[model samples]
Target: MPSGGESMLESDNGTLGWLNFFHKGIGYFAYTMHRISGIVILLYLYLHFFVLSNLLRGGVAFNDLITSFTYGPYDIFIVMDILLSLVIFYHGANGVRLMLNEAGYGLKHHKLMFFILESGAMILMLLFLYYAWQVLLSGGGV
Candidate 1:
């Protein structure tokens, strides 16, 4: 059998090393998702502001830009929007859980709190998506 140092070196080597870092537990999973969602939301905020800036040009320019999102290859944008909404919801819910833990609340029930927060986020995301889908399919044009 390999020595401890040799085993550590082996696990540090390639794809397995990366995969080994995630999903070890609820805390680990939540930490990873929180970081990822935070980054995604930050990037979306930048893009959102940039797009909104187009409105400064004129009503016609703004209308044309918005109109471009309604059909064709831009249909993928709808899926992305839904994903962004879910990420935002997850990030917000997880942030609250983390805040409570830091504040000396729910420390003993950390795992349970993680589960409850994640479930609540999912339920909220589903409800939002249901309404979003209705708006999308009703020819509401986002």
Candidate 2:
């Protein structure tokens, strides 16, 4: 038989080529980005909930924070908000599909669910782009 390196080269030349492996690597990159974005969104949700819970202390502090958020560093906030919206939407929609698949629904409707999830993500992304443009035009006032 051929040596180990030669066997690997044979497989690489056969079906499991380097190009296919590169594409698969890209898929893993997308998956990792999705996971990381989801975690960031979850962290934001926790912070949001914590702030809302502060409504217990009457309106002044919360309202002040809200006002500060509205007018604060417009450029930074606008970019961050747009990015966060995309991340949260993608993460949430993709996460539901993942959960459904994990519960075995995927076995029943794998392609259908994947299409649904992908379409939903695309729609959300477009909506976010539109809204982001609107916000930018509005100078991030609202």
- lDDT by residue (tens digit), candidate 2, 21-48: 3343423333445557867988988988
Tens digit per residue, CA lDDT, model 1, 71-94: 544567777888899899999888
- Best-performing candidate as measured by lDDT: 1
Which of the numbered candidates is closest to the native, going by highest TM-score?
1
lDDT value, candidate 2, whole model: 0.59
In model 2, which regions exceed 4 Å deviation? 1-23, 73-75, 99-116, 125-142
Candidate 2 residue 68 C-alpha distance from true site, Å:
1.5
Candidate 2, number of clashes? 0
